[model samples]
Target: MKKISIIFILFLCISISFEAKSQSFVGLRGGINIPSVNYTNFVRGPIVTGFRNEFFIAPSFGVSYRNMQSEKIGVQIDLNYSTKGWGQLTLLETNTFITRINYLELPFYLHWQLIGKKKLKFFVDAGVYVAWALSAEQEIANDVDLVENQIIYSVEKDNRGDFGIYAGAGVSYDFSIFILQLDGNFKSGFANILPVNPFIKENPPISTNQVPSVQLSVLFPISKD
Candidate 1:
């Protein structure tokens, strides 16, 4: 599956390069992420809460190309990395655990302009995302120290890949030389690729989860004509 996704991304890049003969832009963006985990069982509350609270502002950067200079629609491909996680205390006394999940995401979305030739234009985007887990770690702190005593409840580092749907809306101002944009996006996952270890089930179903994000970016034109 990983190989297939990588190939798909490469194919998209090639296709975009061929179509965007005179359109290309590179930019840098920084933003905040509010991510929450969802579980399959509706009968129970989320296995985790306040997962989004643990995260601070995360930074991202990407490049894009518009096929036709005057066209109001185009395709965009982005590569972004995000840091997100949560922590919790076990039922046992004197034991606490923290889980950190980091990911590298690739999103390909169709971009549409909602307003015509003004300095400020409204836009909407819809796309698919493939995320790879960089790492998952847990830290344990306990007052009593024993040779075989482990404060960490479960260290399942199996969550590796996720597929999600993404949608966003934003406004952009195009200067003769550069463009600036501010956007907010949401992503939800439908599959659980988390690896199962001593702490979690091998196939513990992970349901749709929401990841809300906001970004500010500045783009430089490679060709304005």
Candidate 2:
């Protein structure tokens, strides 16, 4: 009986030590999104209609939670308010037009720690995300010098949802009580997002959406098992 009791206590101690080494984490994340469009052209559109795009900086903010199942592998989940769009602007002219679409997205990432030390870890993350469109909007400025009569257009019907794949690489620094991650991520959309200018159901003005960004996220431990 004494030998059996000792063995059980030793096992419990080993389990507790293992649990203490890996703690689950929660954090806040934010990034800048640069959106671009790829045309699925069946009929060639006008040259002027083709957007001369410049990176329109958009904001993405979210909450991230991580579950560490082992020393080198884990899962990350995030819920975010993300924006996508492009702008048509001529450098020589003041007239400008911009389109923006917003989404509420949930992304699930499979995280692999490739290399690590006590203070830092390098990781690769891959995942898929599903998003619902919150709204689509357009802003137009015919002439910048004149007393501005700006037009804001509300898109009534757009592709309502999107599903996509994401992949990224990052490094995380441990502060003991908190962690900071810096990652560069690319996301590719798998479906059409459009009302396609003339509301053409058969063909869209633009074929699909593209979103790519670099993110900085900070995390805290909610509880340790």
Candidate 3:
């Protein structure tokens, strides 16, 4: 099954590239990643209470290839490394709990250029992504001193293969050579990161990871005609 999928993807890419002519680009994207969860109830320690989920921004970077099928339509594909996790900060700000998970992700987006002028262009994209977990770690700190007053543990059992949806909108600037694009996007996981019945006792009952990001990308024309 995996071999067939790989072959199909390669064939699709070759077919698209064969027709792109001078209407293709290679790009790099770098940005902030805010990982979140969908569930409201999660417990930890001796205190069985809801997790106070907080913003835990991380770095995201990717390389992309895109071929414009028309003035207003294109397909963008990316291979990237991204960070996803959630953190908790209490009212006192003394104690903290954080989970850090990293993944190598591949995403495909259907790109639409809405207002393509000379200097600036507007666009929107929607797509899906597949991600494989690289690492998962959990940390708990009792004091903000950062003097290693914490408990660190690895996730015992995890749903490593993640499937998700992504959507975003932004504008790009044309430098007459390479285009620089800035955008805000969201990636939401449909599957839980934890097993339906986690093996570990401390693990969250249910968690759906969601990432919101602000991205900056630069695209270099493949073969300008």
Candidate 4:
């Protein structure tokens, strides 16, 4: 976690230093995410037998700094508050389980302009990110059982730090003052959030988060002067 923080800070410093020479923009972005977890190499417990895992809807918002090095090339960094998780449902038992994990994330991207040069343009970006877990919660609700609905917070099963790679494509319209951007992005985490599983004796279950999102941003240009 310390190393991740250091790297992010260093990137911010470097980006700020280039702001004087390059074309830069500061922006606010917000989005909706469809998040899911992939669990593999696991020994399924009795509690998991009847449930099917599905994607959960979540929110993502952030501030971004972008520096354009040239007409077709740029770099961007974002600081975001994001949520990711999965949902499980069992129809016969009328039971549902949902997990929500909050994270503070820093992502850096290299952007490539694909089409157009003036007011309207199409672009693509590929990036890597580091994130720290803020909190995690799970909810349990059942209609068939007499037990009351419950919400539980657990850190025992969570890995506090995560890293991932992502890619995106979007269109941007420059209004001479502020740029309005719309993008679709997909993220795939490499770190297994659930690092320990008692059910599997030889190997631990690999559980990673996958999220796809649509985002909108409004950016104001920064003057070199």
Candidate 5:
């Protein structure tokens, strides 16, 4: 599955290059991610109590490609490396446990132009994404003092593959030769990242990932619109 995704991305890149002289835009994007985990059917063990969920700041960057189907409608695809995870704060916010996971994500969007036909435009997009986890780590820290601090690397039980939905709205400006766009988006995973343990199948835990992000991109026209 991972191989197939990689191949598809490559194919898109090639197609974009070949279609450079058309009504298409390709660009680079960078953003900040606020990632968290939602837990359902959680077993409230002793350690789970008194821990509050928190968000962590992470980085996301990628290549974005768009093909304008019409003046008001288009299609977009992005290949990005996104850092995502959630943090748990102990009672009184004295200590914190932050789990970090990094993934390669591909998202396809239906793009819409809500306003403006000239320099500045308002737009919206909705899509779905597939991601493969590349790595995972955990950081433990003491908020009150500097006594306990450690980092652990583990992926033994993590379910790496994730699929999710994404939606965003933003504004863009045309520079004659290139376009600048700013987008704010939210993504929510449908797949459970916490795999069910066979031994504990009767009472398994469930967790899903979500991220909210703001991105800026500079798109150069392959061919003039």
Candidate 6:
């Protein structure tokens, strides 16, 4: 009877140790993002519409901390850099107008794992983003002159930056030392600092806007078992 009790206690200790090891993980992630922006003023007419229909790719980097509560659920926090933009076009009888807005953004999201076991895990994330308009540039081309005029727009009071909400879903594959993730996310702005035309008393004719983005990241774990 004494021997049996000692063996049982030893087995319990081993189980607890294994459980603690599986509870925590830390990793680093870096990826490329293909981003698209939707603007409020995009209308088809004499003026070219939509915030620059062109799609651009940017680089992203992030760090993640995850705590697993059970086999099927976990909590994760990630800090990442995201880039977005849009363009505008104006067609004049004599000249054509093009305007572009670029942003460098920082986002924080809460991650939830939908399926936590096995080599593949699926998850969803939601969060907020604070973005700064890093730069704005414009170009004008004259039909008759055969010359293009280039100018960079300067932001004043109206360029107070932008705030928005973001949500996304992704899947991740775990390897011994690294992990791979693929995700898609969208953001919607609640406020705006639209540019003003002298003829219009109210600036930023459009109020709300949206941006959609897709990302692929390679993550490396900092902690080793």
User: What's the C-alpha lDDT at position 63 in model 5?
Assistant: 98
Candidate 5 residues 1-225, lDDT tens each?
A: 445445655654554455333377899999999998775433443233333676779999999988876667777899999998788765466778888899999988678899987899999987678898899877776553432222222466568888877789999999988999999999988777877665554223656788999999999888545
Name the regions of candidate 1 deviating beyond 4 angstroms.
1-22, 40-70, 86-98, 138-157, 195-204, 207-209
Q: lDDT (0-100) at residue 24 of candidate 1?
A: 59
| Residue ranges of candidate 4 with Cα displaced over 4 Å | 1-21, 44-51, 91-93, 144-153, 197-204
> 39-106, model 2: which lDDT tens digit per residue?
43333233222334556888898999887767787677899999876665654546676778888988
Model 1, position 38: C-alpha lDDT score: 58
- Which pairs in model 4 have colliding backbones? none
The TM-scores, one per candidate, come to: 0.66, 0.75, 0.78, 0.80, 0.80, 0.60
* Global Cα RMSD, each model: 6.6, 11.4, 5.2, 4.8, 5.8, 12.9
Model 6 error, position 150 (Å): 13
* Tens-digit lDDT string for candidate 3 (1-225): 345445545655664665543488999999999887765554455665455666777888999998887677788888989988778766456678787888899887778889978778999987777898898776666654552223232445657887777789999998978999999989888777866554554556666778989999999988644
What lDDT is reached at residue 135 by model 5?
A: 93
lDDT of 1 by residue, 190-211 (tens): 5555443444433334433467
Report how far off residue 86 is in candidate 2 (Å). 2.0
Best model per lDDT: 5
Model 2 ranges off by over 4 Å: 1-22, 40-51, 89-94, 141-155, 195-206
Candidate 4: worst-modelled 10 consecutive residues by lDDT: 144-153
What candidate 6 gets wrong by more than 4 Å, as runs, is 1-38, 41-81, 89-102, 139-153, 195-199, 207-209, 223-225
Stretches off by above 4 angstroms in model 3 are 1-22, 42-48, 90-94, 139-141, 144-156, 198-205
Where does the lowest 10-residue lDDT sum fall in candidate 5? 144-153
